[model samples]
Target: MINLKISEPNPRESVREYAYRILSENILDLVLVPGAAISEKEISDVLSISRTPVREAFIRLSQEGLLEILPQRGTYVSKIDTEQIAEFKFLRITLEQAVMKLACSDFPQKLQEQLCNCLEKQSICVKKRNHEQFFIFDNMMHDIIFTGCEKSYIWKIIQEANLNYARARVLDLSSRQDEIEVLFAQHKEIVKAIITKDTSLGENIIVRHINKVISDVDDLQKQYPEFFK
Candidate 1:
């Protein structure tokens, strides 16, 4: 049986939106593992809501390639697509490297402080072996960079198209906790590059940091053969 955390909908959020958000988050977090069978009725019952919203949410997720619906079979969480992951990685590296270069030129002081605070928390999470929180802050740090560079919309675009890459990253971090410190160090270098206005260094670190997952794809697929396409 699937166990989903039930929560009240956010203010002004439609039931359909709420369902989509919750289900998509679970799918991304790997709580709803890849290729796991699911159903609209099952999700609706789990969330204590009617099936209509859940069905609508399922449709949206399917459009995003996060859910697969069969005419006679059942709904299943989609497997991570390696080809899509590579494409998204290429998109992210291209856009983010540009953003990092812009950030090095003129990142706001307030955002820079926020990045420092996020890194401090990330450091603590690393010390406590908290890969989950580290992952959260890892994304937060990059978001800050985009926001500082005034490219927030690009960040949103990347995120909207990043489902597979995001899941793959979570898998990588969860399966290989030992690499967390190395990631943390690279993050520090990224921040240092931005603060010191080193555009070349910033670009290099961003590419390397983002590509780290691509480099590990072979091993990840080997370990979790069922999770990928």
Candidate 2:
């Protein structure tokens, strides 16, 4: 189990925001596993805050479908819903393809440089066996593509909608740590396609790259059944 550190609440940020950020990070880090019971009082006590703020945080996470606040039982990390995962995958792919199509046509030099830097950073992450850093760099590369297309809004929606898929990707990353090289290769191809302004090439590469992020859902579901519904 990962140890969670409670951060000091910033005066500029409300207690609920602070609690929410901390709790969200912890949950994503799996310090609070799915279906694990959590109480507003315990959280408030631990964070040295009042119950109201903790309660508010719980409400927000629940709204995000990341938590389940039972009426009388208690609040718990929500189990991953595979149906939602599939739905998000479809929605994400559609919007991303549109974004990539624009990016393929525009193919700005600035974004290409950014992507090259991300690819280099991702390569270093692979060498260091740093899954977390690899994931961060991966997102940055994709975000740069979105920026190139002037569609960061779509990227934000994709991020907000794919929490379960994100965690599942993390699990897949752990099992296939060596697969980072292949992922980096795919990223390189996408970048090259974009740099050369090859629309069809970019389309093929980007779809394959994005789909690879969730291709092993069945295996992952089998491995981490408790984390899923």
Give the best candidate by lDDT: 1
Q: Please identify model 2 stretches exceeding 4 Å from their true place.
A: 5-11
* TM-scores of the candidates in the order shown: 0.97, 0.91
Once superposed on the true structure, which residue ranges of model 1 sit more than 4 Å away at CA?
Answer: none
Summed backbone clashes in each candidate are 0, 0
Q: For candidate 1, write residues 79-115 as lDDT tens digits.
A: 9999998888889999998899899999999999999
Error of 2 at 222 (Å): 1.0
Q: Say what the RMSD of model 1 is.
A: 1.1
Task: Kindly report which residue pairs in candidate 1 clash with one another.
Answer: none
User: lDDT of model 1 at residue 20?
Assistant: 94
